[model samples]
Target: MQLLFAAPARKPLQVDRHLRRQIVRYLTTCFEILSPAAEELIPDELEQWGQLRIGNGGDEIHARGYHKLRPDGRDAAFVRYELMVDQEADNPSVDERLEPESQYGELQHIFVLTIPPKTPKVNPHRKKKRHLLLAQIYEAPFKFDEADKYKVIWYKGKLGTGEVVDALTIQCVIDAGEYLYPYIPMFDSIL
Candidate 1:
């Protein structure tokens, strides 16, 4: 005789409003400051705030803004803002670095804000998502060799068949700027 068992239903993840608002505010402010010249060209109909489904099969709060326009009156480049909230307490440390894999394809700009786990919990058997949040904002062309900047990691490899592999990893760890401080009060309250 064969026995049948029913699988348990999964519950939807809860949305944290405070964290979401912080992420939106940060992204909006950055867009306004970074690309002031192209701001007027962006279409007003685009989504200012909404939920974006990331590659990891999870929905994150996102704010989208256009920054550039093409000669034909079309949007050329836009910025995407993402917020990743870590609920698992036993997760690893929060890395301020941004990886290429974390970004969507060919976006002109991508900003991710990660909220660390509120409390430490034990969960050794489960796997966690790999995501990094913004820790600092730096002006372009800034020298990495500066005293405050962190060192970048370079990885090179070759396949047995003589194929070469090239990769570069950069980690950012600077103090969050004044614009980001407003969100801190909300983050502290939630924790």
Candidate 2:
């Protein structure tokens, strides 16, 4: 009867130049911040792992699947989050060390990595357990309007990918009822 169980589903790991750069940046930034876990990971090891489980947890600890990233403080994943991407601020005009500052990017996926407790005991430390998060993300480069500082211009496109972000990310931002946008490429005025 055990054979009846389905094999864990996995998508092909397609890391293009942009994604690769992002991964490298993520790793480098993590290391600079003194993250011990980040220190262990090298780019060469990504191919070593067969799969990176998404959507649901693979272990008993994080088996409760799918938390809606809402503003209600229910889930760790936020819809429109300013993801801390960079470790340093861009030329801070104030008294600050020439160091990394919290920078934000667009959030793509939230991986809640379940780490078993040391010494084989149930870990009592559950203070914001979901905060143990790894996020797949992207950032749009922005330029303030020359004449009108109030207006901002930024780059946002698939950059060749079929979809810019997961549909769930969009769904979370929408109202309680149904809402719809044009298919693929639409709207003459916007673009």
Candidate 3:
């Protein structure tokens, strides 16, 4: 017979996010509806994200092209939590001329913030679930490369002391990269 008792898996460390006003405002701009329901779901004073969620924790969800970050997924040599800015999804040409290479910060402690579905008693018209993948961005304030402007693949960075964790946008993410791995010559290894 199978054992009646079993030990739980070790819990992953979580980082609490204290979202700022700017990030919260950005969310509204991203999906503007200006309806009463929208206002309630995303009020200007909604500073807390699902009641101050601690980092990724053990509750992992799927992020496209980065299954390693998921709690339940396969085909990864190793689960990578590192996320980089998506060059293809964003305006690379504009950034190439205007922004610095180091401005496309690094993402850490990535997690999926899924909005719970309504219980369906009154709101049976609900559709698919919504998931927002968020992370803390770290920028290399001192590093710069002329040739790699707006297309930096690798660089050293430090997360600010009072940085907001949930300030990421879906359009800015691309793929995964090993954090703290030895610096390599290949520029594409950033993620």
* Top of the candidates by TM-score: 3
Model 1 alpha-carbon drift over 4 Å, by segment: 1-66, 76-109, 115-191
lDDT of each: 0.24, 0.30, 0.33
The residue-level lDDT of candidate 1 at 94 comes to 55
lDDT of 2 by residue, 14-43 (tens): 445554455445544533433344333323
lDDT for each residue of candidate 1 in 71-120, tens digit (9 for 90 to 100): 44422121112233344435558544433331111121122222223212
Ranking by TM-score: 3, 2, 1
TM-score of each: 0.16, 0.32, 0.34
Which regions of candidate 2 are displaced past 4 Å?
1-8, 33-78, 84-93, 97-133, 139-191
Candidate 2 C-alpha error for residue 90, in Å: 4.9
Give candidate 1's error at residue 60 in angstroms. Answer: 20
Candidate scoring better on TM-score of 1 and 3: 3
lDDT of 3: 0.33
Residue-level lDDT of model 3, residues 90-122, one tens digit each, is 665554233212233434334334444561321
Ranking by lDDT: 3, 2, 1
Clashing residue pairs, candidate 2? 83-104, 85-103, 87-100, 87-101, 88-100, 88-101
